[model samples]
Target: MSDLTFVLAGPVRHGVRLHAQALGRRTRGAPLVNIEDGALPPGPVHLHFTDRIFGRDALDAAERLAALVGTRPLSVTLHDLPQPSDGASFERRRQGYARVVAGARGVQVSSEHERGLLEQVWGACGDGAMPPVAVVPLPVDRPTRWGPPAGAQGSTDGAVVVLGFVYPGKGHAETLAAMASLSTGVPLVAVGAPSDGHEDLLTELEDEAAAQGRSFVCTGYVTDEDLERWTARAAIPVSAHTHISASGSINRWISAARRPIVTPGAYVGELHRRAPWAVTVAADLPAAIGAALHDPTSTWIREAEWDGAALPDTGTAAAMQLAAIEAIGLA
Candidate 1:
């Protein structure tokens, strides 16, 4: 049996799978094992990925997971919690997360903003005692060697680029709208596949692009290699999220591409504190892209900072997880 087990109660998707793979590589000789919907191997500590509880029965599912992992030294991490559309929904989600907190030895959050939000919800739910909490930023792997993807390189030709999975708040429509009004007639390419049940949105966006006379292309989905190549081709990249809590996509873009990004005011504020090269824009998206194009120096500075700095190591991340788990009174 391993000393630690990573429990993936749900499907191993992007962030969850990436973190697990990194941990496996780092925790050699420590006997780290990963399992899904099966008995957890005997271990000193177990960490569960609880970032995908957005269903209608989210609270019930959490309770069931807690019961199944009974009496084990378990910790939980939320990649991104569902944004509550109203007060009632907020309360519902809070109660669900509270149940998870009550069961786990501790909880790990990615950012200070996320920690604050968790605390606020814990307070509102009147959960007796908030569990031990730690702020551990997601591990960013080192940049790989850059190579232009076949045919993808120079395919976009100075067009605006938006990368990552297509979801509701990703601001795809908003980006097309902004493109429609640009005087310079810049092309736009939105790369990546839509989430389940969101395929229609892509069709709508295509029709809207035609109606508005904006040159738009949807690459559906591309490999990581292609993503990097496409990103390098972008004249200016846009993060245009309507509401962003924690974005792995943004982190990868900034760290790898080292290019200037045009994002909303909130990201601009957040990144400026850490990465000053990020530019913020108002409601007018075209103007912001134009501004970013004019100041490529800022992007260069941002990129230079990343090139000089090293990303957090997986071994360090494993050490931090172990410390947090042990702090909760687990052996």
Candidate 2:
């Protein structure tokens, strides 16, 4: 049995909380504790850290985490880590995340790309020895039902689906522009709601889609079943994020057996390297989408690969986390 306690903080639907729940299920004997609830069990605690989940801003989140952990040994899996792409808030977030990393007994990240981002922002530890950092690639869930719906083969009648919360730089505007450029006429669908403070962006998107004589729909906050259906029906699934350390959306598409057209980036390249069959990387997203629309089957993962041994799941992630915690002497 493990001695670690997994701390759950954030909205129920948030990615961090969802990941925590998935990890907790696979991590035997580790109690999942709600951080909102007053006391916690005795022992080292593991938190899936992200500034948005913990507080209003980066500095506030760091301070709140320090207070919550108090004297307990803390190991964190950092998410939404600071990078030069953050523009105006880069330094502030870098400062706050540095403090968080400095205080942790050990740290975990989802990908090598993210680890590089952290090292760039935080630099080497005081003595020049690198902090204990573990790289656990984010797990891809196996869908309850794999592959697209029957008769979906080579069909361009379906909408172009973009999964996850809508926000600035999340690929929505780029996707819209691409669709407009292609004049594909295929509706652009956001399979999730807008992120907080970005609701206006949806209105703008709808107006743009209308002006371009293309259809657009925001299926805000869909159920898992609905998401699967959307993926199954999508003519083209895209992950064109301009600023990403790690992308859950790409993994989510993989889980659904849909190989999305992903924009090239360090993290995307890493994922592509690991599972070349999972995504189609393209620099010109519009051309990629147009090609995908012409041959929809190009976006569907073959049955053999979906059932193959190459795919990693939450269980694999949990085992890696357990091993990492033990190596850090926290388990």
Candidate 3:
């Protein structure tokens, strides 16, 4: 019989589903089972991102799960508890989050920052009787292999690149402005399209790039294979995000290509606490890029040296998660 069973009540195509799939394959000794809806079979149930699955209906489901499980331990791994885009929705989600926090026997978070956020979210409820939280680094699914080697000299030949979804708060405009302000003309390429209503912002960024005689190209969503090719061609990768919590994109990029990265300072304190290979700078973007170009390998990916919290692959991540569940007395 399987010693652990992960209940991913969320959508089948979600990111957590992928993690569960990879973990199931890597785990040893204890057989692992994954199920969708209906009554959870026997054994402990670890609810994954319940809010994402049930949305406003999350509290009711959480309460039901807690009651149905009886004495069997019920734990939760919070993937995201985002404040809804609007006021009414935010209040509803907040209440739902409180209920889950109070009901679960234990909780798991990816980082210290995440734990602190959860405390702030549910601190006032039930006299702050929140479940104990175990911190574990989130797993990243990296490409099987890096594309052909980028030039070792790290010279961009006067071109700047930022890849990923072009959305508000992703620093797309700021990066373009930074590139334009460079003393030398450096073209900028953003390998993504504006999400939904953000199309105008893309036009604005393109115009800004053109005004400065720098070409800005929006590749409009590329496949994994193409992204790898684009990344390998760049002299330096820009891991720019104004706000993020345990970013999968940044982690994957840093792992796949060992080149130096230009990132926001806030990300340094939160994600890469001990990642000296990453260059964290706020403002003065041109200077930061120049520095990264000079020594691209300064902060090269060293999976073995990630603050003793290295999860180089999915298998290692699965082992860590299994150990955490056992630590909480759930397995």
Candidate 4:
């Protein structure tokens, strides 16, 4: 095992933090240090980083990461890296992320798509060479028998479900608009609450759904049991992220033995190429939703017991990350 200490930052429920925790669990005796403790442990450090997890904004997060890097060997697995989709903050966030990359001994991104984004945004470091970057795809848990089979007793007919935290670009609005055009009066349900600052978007969605004579249901936050139930019942599980570096939500659907309808993008395209049966890519949300509702069986895998062998699991990802960290040559 490498001598790298894994640094955990961000809220407990945050995706980056949860990923770090998952990796830490698989790393056995490797030290897991909380960044909030005000001091990082000595020696090489590994961090699962996103700007918002470290500070109020990208620039501030970069400064914080720089302070933490003082004299120690550091490597990072970047999440939610800035892209052209960031609009006004793209340049500023790119500069901040560049600073983080410059100070790192190595870098890890979850997908080749994201690595391409990193190369586009950050390019070469000051030495005219990019940091050692590795691609470690996000973990997908093995499919298990979670609840009753789909469309049993508790299923919601024709419901279009969007799982995970709702935010402005999370595709809730797009789903809402799509559902409005549909003749099916089924509700568009969000299985989780809105992201911290986007609460107003939920209200707007509700009002818009009402005005359009469609139903929209935000379950706020539900227990894991309830989430599985919702997933099992969803007629059409959809993931329509407008800006995504990597998506744990899509994997969540896969893990539940559900094939989610996703919007096309580099990451989604890569995922579809790898596991075509796991997701359906749709260029038009409304048309896709309509087609899916017309024949709900199109969103399911044929295998009775899927092992999720097509994608990396948490253990495999942790091992891949450890190998990458070891290649960085921590002293």
Candidate 5:
């Protein structure tokens, strides 16, 4: 059997899913099982982002599906927990997982922030029942520079790109506002799946950009090539995750594209303090972004060499979670 099977129950073709697969592959052939929405499994790690939209029936179904995985040292891991959208189902998902994993020791949350989220999730458990939730900081592949080739003039072009699952809370509007204040006519690239909430907001953004004579592109959903395309072309990538633990896309873009980043103080913000390439805008995201955009190459040379290996090459994050489960079982 593989070290762990990471079964993701979602639209399996997305960026997060793909990164999980790549990460799984790197983690000793740990299987990244692609199951339908409710079809879950007991494995070292489970990529669960449960929401009320999936409903109680689906949530209950997921619990049973996990039970069917036969209790082989499970570490049910929820990514981006306290899922920004739903609090109830997120509770159900974690509660259901506690039943499967039983002791707190087997349950592992991927992002450090998830530990508190799990505590809140356990409050829904009532009558005292909670699991041990250890947050393994998500590992990002080392960034590779995708900037211009040797003779490309666009290498010096000024642009600030924000890559993520775009929506109201994602701060797209704020990013645009930041660009307006910058001296350079900043080109902003908004990438990721645009939620319904951002639909009209996006149109307004494009119209404003056209009116202002600024350059902008919004790739609704980016494939792998598109991912590299946006990052390589960007001078700075804006990350304003309102409610998230950690973002795989952010890490991948950071590594593969190697641009300096303007990020909100999310889970692993501390690590960025040590790395020159990253700067956090905890209190004022837009203004922070403006600063970065105005000087994308500010500490370019210095930041270029800065790397925390904050995200190291862990073969499979799932495998590590699995190994933790196995150790738990022995105890």
Candidate 6:
């Protein structure tokens, strides 16, 4: 049996590394490759890649890394695809995929939406039209139960927390207004840099925080440990995202703490159905946030924290898929 070698191409911080180690232990015996140094292995059965950025450096890196792999069965596991943006880097990325398919057997995308993006890639590559997508859910590893921290726990003065990267499409500005309307002294945390927002936007958020004297922790780029700490401590972990497909970390925190979330218009209904207590509202509208926050206990937030099970280790998903690949007796 040939062992699988998984690659982590870019700046995958400590938590991801720890998860990879855990996945490696769970993988029976396959070696998981950490390509943080941008080095390629000799040759593995398949080449797996994960990415979430659309920045030039990230796109260029993906192109170069794809070259190093030199045509193995490729999987471009993208967390989010740029659909609303003007910069069609997706087309450029498709060209890279074309280079892969000229020698590689096939390519796999992470989600159905992402699969659509891949089809666009193929079309841009002048590969004619592609077919339907085959999507597999990432994972639902969230703990069934959760409690407060070891040190202390208490209710907020009515602060609603936003717990992911701060991108323009993630509904930062919209949430700011909604929070402003709410009576609670709620604050928004712009965790990571999600998308391209005008510089003035950050300045606006600063002004809002300054005006209210509320606590809005704009920790630009936090370590994984800090990410977990912040997510776990918040009273309400809201995600007013409108750009991305799915938020694994946001979902994980919800599952962990049954935390109330005011999701964007896209995910509002689905989130309400799955976890009714977790509020999902239109992130573009401040009224939505105000409405959800109004009923603090409206089947939205109960009691939970992100218990480290937001996204299943894609390494595990890869292992499962790789086994199926082997079952067919093909390399």
Q: Can you tell me which runs of candidate 3 are displaced by over 4 Å?
A: 1-3, 9-14, 29-42, 50-73, 81-93, 124-127, 140-154, 183-185, 191-201, 259-267, 278-283, 294-312
Error (Å) of candidate 1 at residue 84 is 3.9
lDDT by residue (134-221, candidate 1, tens digit) is: 8666555544534223443232236777887777778777777776665435667787888777888888887887787767778976
- Estimate every model's Cα lDDT from 0 to 1: 0.62, 0.85, 0.62, 0.84, 0.57, 0.52
Worst 10 residues of 4 by lDDT: 147-156
TM-scores of the candidates are 0.82, 0.95, 0.74, 0.93, 0.74, 0.72
lDDT of 5 by residue, 1-331 (tens): 4455666554555544565555556655556676564444444444443432233543564465555455454455555454436554565566554444353345666665677766665565523656556666566555455344454224325677777766766756667766675654667778776764557777877887776678777877777787776666666666655565666655665566454444455564644653535444436655665565555554133334645454554554545655655565621
Instruction: Pick the winner on lDDT between candidates 1 and 6.
Output: 1
Alpha-carbon runs more than 4 Å astray in model 2: 124-130, 143-146, 151-154, 307-309
Best by lDDT: 2
Local error of candidate 2 at residue 63 (angstroms): 0.6
Cα lDDT tens digits for candidate 6, 1-331: 4545656544554223443344445555566675555555554534444333323643564566566666454433333444435265655555544544443444444455666655665566645444323443344455444554654223445456665556566667656766765553667777655434455667777787767666566776677677666655655556666655555555556555545455544434544454454444544556554554554443234444232332344455556555544543433
Off by over 4 Å in 1: 29-34, 51-56, 85-89, 142-157, 183-185, 260-262, 265-268, 278-284, 294-303, 307-315, 329-331
Q: For residues 1-331, could you state the per-residue lDDT of candidate 4 as single tens digits?
A: 5567888999887878999889888997688998888788778898988998888788899898989868789989999988887889888788888888888999999999999988987663234678999999999877666443845532335678998898878988888887777764778899898888989988899898889887789999888799888878788899998887789999989888788899998899899888887898999988898888777777776565354666899999999888898887862
Clashes of 2: 0
Task: List pairs with backbone clashes in candidate 5.
Answer: 26-315, 27-315, 27-316, 104-131, 104-132, 143-255, 144-255
| lDDT of candidate 5 at residue 155, scale 0 to 100 | 31
For candidate 5, which ten residues in a row score worst on lDDT? 49-58
In angstroms, how far off is 202's CA in candidate 5?
Answer: 2.3
| Pick by TM-score: 2 or 6, better one | 2
lDDT comparing candidate 1 with the true structure = 0.62
